[model samples]
Target: MLMRIILTALPFLSLATASKDTCEWPSWQDALTTCHGPPSTYTVKASNGKGLGLFSAHDLDVGEIVMRETPPLKISPPEIVKGSGYPMPAVTKLVRKEFDTLSSAVQDEIMSLTYHITSSKEATMDKLGIIFRTNAYNSGKDIGLFPKIARINHSCRPNASYYWSDKLNKRIVYATRKIKKGEEVYVSYIPLLLTQEGRQKLLDRYGFKCSCDACAQERAAQDVSDERRTTIQKAFADFEPQLTLEPPRTKKARQQARKNAKASLQLTELVHQEGLADYFAKAYRVAAISHARVKDWKVAAIWANKGYELKYIEDPDSPYTMEMHNLTSNFIANWESELQVGQ
Candidate 1:
């Protein structure tokens, strides 16, 4: 079945190459021209043997969606690794089937991606399996192969972050902080909270050394950041119990709530300074809720407003975005008048 698809598309392959302009080579970066909704402010360039990378063409603000793309071929993990069931799934077979169904142009684009040839004696399915494993993003229960999004390289302290939009059936990458013109925008491919050594181990699996700013930091600085990250992780975990308790009924419960909120707020601030922009909007929301839980509406309103602004950047038209907006507006409308009354 897979061979049939490849054979069918083989005839159209020549047309795919014939359509390319000099700028659009067989190279991976040139494939950006084939992606959906890529911002003009970014350009594709060589990344010192990392192949093609996305770079800011001009100054970009925080919360800006740098690029948004819907994957032409998205497959679930179970499909990729179908175990022995009624019918066992074959990873390579499934991938090849999907690849064949794509337009010749699209097939060419997918073929141009940066991937390792895993085995000298590997079959076509085996090679495609390695490519998909290397480049696919986790989309809930499914694994998605996004051509353009896959181009953005890894960084431990990434300036941009990507989010999957169920509604759009697309993945959006946004700048978490100000990105200067010509600066390379990166996303942390692994867990942000991992220590340098841990992050290195993960990067090794992808066949490259991560020289991102965070990973390149001096030992002393890295240790300090790691310690703070560890503290943030532990502190947030401790606060989870109190946060889960339904509105503190007794004095002890109330006290514990306040303590938990305070600790969370502090830890979140450190997280922001450590260049973890992905968590900033979340941290602000946590702070707002903490203050509001104690009837500190004025402070809550302030934090909620900030959270709303940041949330809007991260996800426009999202239910969570609306919730943040509602939180800020309601808190402000209710508290602003009261504070003025006393004044």
Candidate 2:
């Protein structure tokens, strides 16, 4: 059985020195002890105009583990509060219930995370709720708050990526590309397979416009970025099209599988051109499965190894990485049998 790291309760100091009435500017240092991982490879400070942003302390190689943390605050989606008729409140009633359990200092820490409030009336009603809505990361069935990780800002072409790791019971951030020392660390807050305009609309909710590579392109370059992203979206549809349990016994069926394997390889190249480092694993998985469908075990296993390398860096303890690990390591025999058949 896989071991899970339980999130133990944090003992917070009293906020007797500050006003508990309203959330003031937050400092991630307030939750310092809760942070786990390497010794300060990042510096959290004010970004140009984007609030607080994290920066790499030294040159970081691709696949370096940037940071890791077990969220101090983790709870089920507040919408689970069933009796409400409305779709949901900004923070849901869970905010009040959870907030009351924390020390005044932690309560203030939660409140100081985000500035988004639907209205002053709502803020007065539940300030913690507003902050919760603004900063929570949707981790599977639950929502969690990782104060320091939240300091990493958004970029349409982010150099790093993060995901909640159920296997390790923590959140891990990894550099998807080489990052220069002192450069701001970024991760996409929205899906990146969208046109510049489409991404802007989604980012508006975060109260900032993205100026990453895709969004910062010149007019002509912007057109090309949109076209590339659009193509990627279309290509992904056939990335792993359905196949039968056994390799196509019919000539035409076998031809179709061959075409699929070829398309998967082509999409891999396109994804690289688009610079979606975080998506490299998915692209490789598609190729691995597609090649296996054609009974090309050698090529399929190679693709699986490629995916394992990247995912191992991105999320070492994630189920996806574990799957790749099994496919390439000790359990390769069983994995080969599982992929030995397809239409």
The residue pairs that clash in candidate 1, if any, are none
lDDT of 1 by residue, 1-343 (tens): 4333332433323333354333343322232232345555677889876789989877777756678878888775443324632111365566778888899998777777877554565445456667777788777566678887888998888899987877668888878888988999898888777678877887876878888888778999999988877776676666555443146789987897788667667967898878888777777777777777776776777777677767655665568878877777666655656666777
Tens-digit lDDT track for model 2 on 255-296? 988998898888889889889887788888888777877866
Cα deviation of 14, candidate 2, in Å? 50
- Once fitted onto the true fold, the runs of candidate 1 whose alpha carbons sit more than 4 angstroms away are 1-38, 76-89, 116-125, 140-142, 244-246, 333-343
Instruction: Please provide TM-scores, in order, for all candidate models, with all chains considered together.
Output: 0.78, 0.77
Report residue 282 deviation for candidate 2 (angstroms). Answer: 0.5
Point to the candidate with the largest TM-score.
Answer: 1
RMSD each, Å: 14.2, 11.9
